[model samples]
Target: MGHCIICGTSVDGVVCRSHQEDVAFRFTGNHPNQLTPGRFYEGTVDGFADFGVFVDIGDSVTGLLHRSELDRRLESLDWDEGDTVYVQVTGVQDNGNVDLSWSIRQSPREFRGEVIDSPEGDRLPDDEPTPTTETEPEPEPEPRTADESRNDEEPEASTNGGSASVEPQSTAGPIDSGPPERVTVDALEESVGERIRIEGRVVDVRQTGGPTIFEVRDETGAAECAAFKEAGVRAYPEVEAGDLIRLTGEVERRHGGIQVETESLKPLAEADAEAVVERLDDALEAEAHPGEVEPLAEDPALADLTDEIADAAGAIRRAVIESRPIVLRHTATADGYVAGAAIERAVLPLVREQHDREDAQYHYFDRQPLEGEDYDMAAATSDVTRMLDNRARHDEKLPLVVLVDTGSTAESRDGIELLDVYDVERLVVDADPGFETSDVADGVVPDDGSITTTVLAANVACGVGDVRGEIAHLPAVSYWEEAPERYAELAREAGYGADAVRELREAVALEAYYQAYEDKRELVADLLFAGDDEVRSLASHVSEQFRAKLDDELETVRPHVETREEGDVAVAVLDTDAFTHRFDFPPTALLLDALFRDLRAEHDRLVVVGLDEADLQIRSTEGIDVRELAERVAERVPEGGVLASGVRRGRLSFLIGEREAVREAASEIAADLAA
Candidate 1:
């Protein structure tokens, strides 16, 4: 038997089957069926066709090089008839028609070895002559001892031409050829500068200008491993995200973060991979849950939702462990901003602890503010498009979408359905009684509007990680009126008094209105969680602007407000388009809320309705089904095309041309219902 050329292993041919693909072949047989698929062969361009080009594998065999198999456009080909080229034989049909594909390596020199394929057998090229019986036979050398033979047969160097330095030896010395003991990523800090082996699943793979970075996660934690081939080239291209791989590398620090310099990375066998997966699943199940914690305040609604809150928190923590990105969507309002920020404050630290990359927090968590109170189709489309792009470009996993202070009402059903189609994990935290529960969400914290969404989110935040103090004041800020006494005391202990919390709420509300679509993470954090001096200074400045804008709007609308008495109910009405800023800060919704609160204080029972050209907003202390009211109005004025939108916030929309008629009918209907 001959020895394999790449490795000194006994084989029937010059190269073993394992390394046969590493070398290219020159087909000498005439029939197409004699060609072997998946092996590269030297060929000549015969001619071009409308669909593809024809390549002659040998003098008698021709194959079609379909345009679909080309890396570039077929018209971009610069080949001339009879020019030598390299192509891979993809398949040979039963009819003996051969199919060829493009090969990046155009010359045989690019391959490790090249041999001729003949009907007799494979053999070396003409330059390397073989010994014949007709010629003189050389004298045989004396047999060497086993030890001497082993010493002489040195391991052949790899000729794959990849730039990765895949030496599996330890830094101190040559380790045993058997698999090394596996180390967890969390323990990598102690093993810096020491070679180690690790087994995990690849969470993400990113190609940089210098190295290919693989974010791998095991039971303990996740870390980045960089494999270098050449500048701007991919290394270990076969390794992909979600692959269960066994990696050998040296732990090192880069830019104050732990990184592994990959020596060798290969996917594990099925049995070994299953074992690793089982281990990871066990650890993840144990660590994904948080310790039992009570709600921040003593409210019946929040107290009743304790288990659901814990489930939401557990999902967020589990996402961090799996290296899945968390996308937070919230309404662009004071309560919404506070609720979203509370969750962000709790999750950022966990992200840092779970990932070794310095930028892991940014990569793993993102917050987005919604323009309207509902998570509508527009918002869902934007989110889906961006996440799909991230998955395609970076090999990132689909993100966990958490909707806060919104997405509870039926208005958000369409958006939630879109996310369900992709099988994305979803969690919703809203205090609106109008919440439409669905089996699609992984977790939901529903309330009867006795508490604000900020309170629910803060409680969930506590269950996620230990950042209770960081977000203690957020629940208080969410309440425009008196916050729960317990939450107020918690905020005081966190160094924020009632006035300070109000200032922060005002600042966030004003900022949230201006850039309604932007998260404004840094600015919001400064307003809520910065040092006392910074928070006081920034919150005071922004609060002053908020008060000025709000007071101006209240003053302008109060003069136009028309008050009328219908039985025991005091009905107040104002033309929003004429009396208030149609497209400015202190939005119509906020203005209506403030006006309704003020009117309620003056009158025993009050209903404030702000009428615009095509929209109407109502606010009342009594529980009213705004959607039912809209349906009644639509029946009375069939030509108005009235529709109930944003039922949780009490909003109605109608055709602009029929606004006057719808307005009159809505006022009469609302009066009768109140009476």
Candidate 2:
């Protein structure tokens, strides 16, 4: 028996079977079994087939390099008939039909392995690394010799006289030999701005507009490392997913997360490939799960909805880790903005943590509000078009659509069904529990009148541990009318007073109308979370402007509003299209909300119908069914199709031909109900 050159273990030859593949051995035997299944071997391109390329391994054997084993198409193969290449034997059948796969590195010399045979058993080309003394502290390793240059260089095609070859050479010199100071991906947070080295297998490779992002997974967790070559050009062209590589870069803290700017990346030898892959597998198995959730201590009722919250938290966390983008859809109101912004704040940080791109927040997370209380087919079509464009241009994965405050009712079924056709991930975090939202959404956090959508979103944010402090006052900002006691305290503790919360609510509402197309990201965030010093003055100014405009419109419209008593209920009707400013500040929706709340405590609100041309919107309070009223209006004027419009938005429309008849009929119904 002889000692193995690598581990110094006793074996039948100079190299053991475990480390035999590490050394590229020249085949001396005449049998097909002598070739290692996975070891790269030198071969000559014989010819091409429709399915694969034929390769001549040695004088006695020819292998078929199957097209299925190639990373790209078979027609894209650039090798000529006589050109030499490298391939791995994936399988050898009973018929001696050798099946081969393409190898990125055609030169076996790029690897650390080298073995030779004589009259005696096999022997390695070099001696094992010498052991250092244990008494003294371990010093940095010395530079490797010419024969050990493979320890530093990245594996690719090695040239021999301008032609690809499998022979090892002494041309390239040694590299930094000491094992790089290794850090797990999870430890990147504490080592921000510190230059560190991390070794892991590449799980994914993405090319962005600026740089190439490689998601590397080590024993602790996964993180993105960015390497730049040029605009739209791939960095580290030879590096592919599943390659075990050692990356050297500085840990940068940006984008509300941590990323490594790669200075150097060297693919490790095949000898340690198994170990690296196993370590990554074990780390993923152990760390893939999101942390367990605890109910918001401030709200005990959340305990009743803990399971759904946990599921939401898990889905969000998984999306971040797996590099899936999040698209948030909310109602286009103050409450909707608050809920959408809260999740945006939380998810941005996590997105920054998971990805290493300056625009990763925008790429990974989106906050889109519905037109009103309805997420109809138009919204879903827009989402599909936008996401499909992103997928085609940037090669982005399908995003997780998070519906906030809306999309819980059956009204959003068609929109949800459209998204379902693409198998998109949907999560609904809503306060309304009246409808079966669970039938559509993968996870639904529905609380019946107990909390606001912002509170539910904040709970999910807190559970995920991303946007904690930033969204403190978001719940209070959502309450334009009245905030719940628990969330109000949270806002107060976050340094926002009741007056400040009111100003923010009014400001967000005002801004949400003009740029109804946009999320008003920075403006809303500053007003809600940045405090009195930064945005309070702006908030106060905007609030004054908002109130002044709202008052003027209400004063002008109220004098013209026709009021009638029916039984014990009083109905208020206004020609909103003519009386109020249609193109100006306060939209009909906000105007009605403020007008109704101003009169709710004093007047019995059977319904407030705002007639605009052929459309009518109803703000019905005191449990007066708007649907029934719409039906009555339709029956009174048979020619007018003044029927119930939508189940959720309390809307009805009349035919233009019968507008005058509907007007006459409305006055009759008002007088007949007088008690």
Candidate 3:
């Protein structure tokens, strides 16, 4: 009989049956049959297959954690071979094969207690000291150096140069060896093939097919250190990201970058870790903020948002310094693309300059285009999944999510909250003034009709890096109508004339519709920042296509358009479903924009209504609130079940069965523009 570790109740083993679920067991038996069903067991990842992962519970017994049992997709599992994980033994087959299920409790600290389950009986783990009544008088301990402390905690090297065995701490250091002097990661260039020690925080860890790479960051900079255990195996299962570690290795130039071939790596003691963290904090504080960069063309609206823009820039710079990924999510529109491209131009240069890796730019910065103006749940969920997968698989820090021309309205609150749940740093830059400014974002720059989102992002980008010339024309390109003279002049100063800017805007709009989801970073960069000849050639060709497509769509819709007037407002209504191509180029939003521009030339106060079977789009010169319009329509025609879906795009949803009534009500509301 034994006492339960938690309640001290008498039981057959160390843990009672009622408390078994709360404790994790270390299997000591050699066969699969020894594993008790429904009991959690600590296991090491043996290998992975297409169907599932092979986990070894003990020396001889292996279990299959099938993909179906995983909480996430099989490809999303971040566990490398030899990583210690927890699993529940679901059953043992007739042939002694074991089936395991995923356990929510991953870390041992999450469990109430740990026990050793063997063929003899269950017992406590070896590390759990036995309680004793006798006490011994302790002698005064001598002060130990940081190197000696690390040596005591270092894992014993295996004879085959595979997995390591952790041994109890010893008071004495290695025989006939003195402590190695610590060096910064930046100073490793001069010490190729030389063995040296470095102390830094482990910023990231990635498990490759051949070796485990640890991204170590000291006060000077960050660099990768490769530690080999076995192919497709974790080198040091105990060391993880965010740990302060002391590592001794040989500096070697690998694949055109500096890498450390690790000989010994271990966590630093608390005091040493704190000292290193303090040093890193001070250094990051000193270097993370970029030099002051003024806005290209200042407006009072932008001036009011100066603090927010500075904060956004600071957040981006700090993310780069900390080696965290930067994810820019923007609306899939001309303005949004311009905004995203401006920031991308600024960030890519910084990423290249900051990291030594050849592929660091692609790895650190990402731009994803959202289909709608709002960062809805779908987009946020996708972002969360990708970020979590990166963190789990690569041990990467959660990225800074920058939402440009999206994630500002009340409709995006749910998505913003999801990011908030993960404590992700969010920076929003939108021209929409209806955004929540309280606690939804770490930094936000909301404009009031004076500037476009591209202008805001360009200003923020200037603070991120020195890319003023590269993105000077983006602000002018974002404006659908005539851009402000100041921004147009700024573009001219940057070598882009008014015709060049207009052509680039049209080219981006056309391209943005084709691959509505893709970022098209290279193509956008060429169109915006390529040499004058290339830009003019590409932009002119693409803009020709844009004009042709728009003209074709307009010709088809013009004949079907019906004109109505209530009081002084001219209302042009088009049954978009019947008149326009549903799946072709010039999407409804873009089509409506062209129609509005054409009809606006005829009437002073006009509203263009693109009416579909289930939804309607409105474009007005009167600055009508789409949400309020939807409300009035819903009250007038209750059977339509009308709802305001997208405010920025002036979109409303209604029941298909009541399409005619909804159309009439929407047309009536559109006439209210004259009011």
lDDT, each prediction: 0.80, 0.69, 0.81
lDDT winner between candidates 1 and 3: 3
Superior by lDDT: candidate 1 or candidate 2:
1
Q: Write the per-residue lDDT of candidate 3 for residues 333-384, one digit (tens) a residue.
A: 9999999999998888888888765568878999999978898899999999
Q: Over the stretch 1-675, how does candidate 2's per-residue lDDT look in tens digits?
A: 666654555677655544443445544444576665644566789999898999877656788988867755677678899887877676678888887875645575644455654334455545644322223344575564452354346432211111111222222222233244678888999988666788887767876433567888888778888775543357777776666787766687544566787756667655555677788666544454445665444676576777777678778876776677888888878888888887777778778887655567867788876776767799999999988997777557788888888877777889998999999988888876665656777654555566677778877877666556667777877876778877788778888889988988888888888768787788888777765575578888888888899999888788877777765666777888889999998888778777777666767545566777887766656433445667788888877978766544556778978876776565445333321
Q: Which candidate is the best by TM-score?
A: 3
Residue range with the least summed lDDT across 10 consecutive positions in model 2: 157-166
TM-score of each: 0.72, 0.62, 0.73
Q: Under the 3 Å rule for N, CA and C atoms, how many clashes does model 2 have?
A: 0
Badly placed stretches (over 4 Å) of model 2 are 1-203, 207-219, 223-303, 443-447, 466-468, 532-534, 624-639, 642-646, 660-675
Distance from true location, Cα of 601 in model 2, Å: 3.4
lDDT leader? 3
**Candidate 1, residue 384: CA error in Å?**
0.7
How far off is residue 49 in model 3, in Å?
Answer: 23
Off by over 4 Å in 3: 1-182, 187-197, 208-211, 228-233, 248-263
Ranking by TM-score: 3, 1, 2
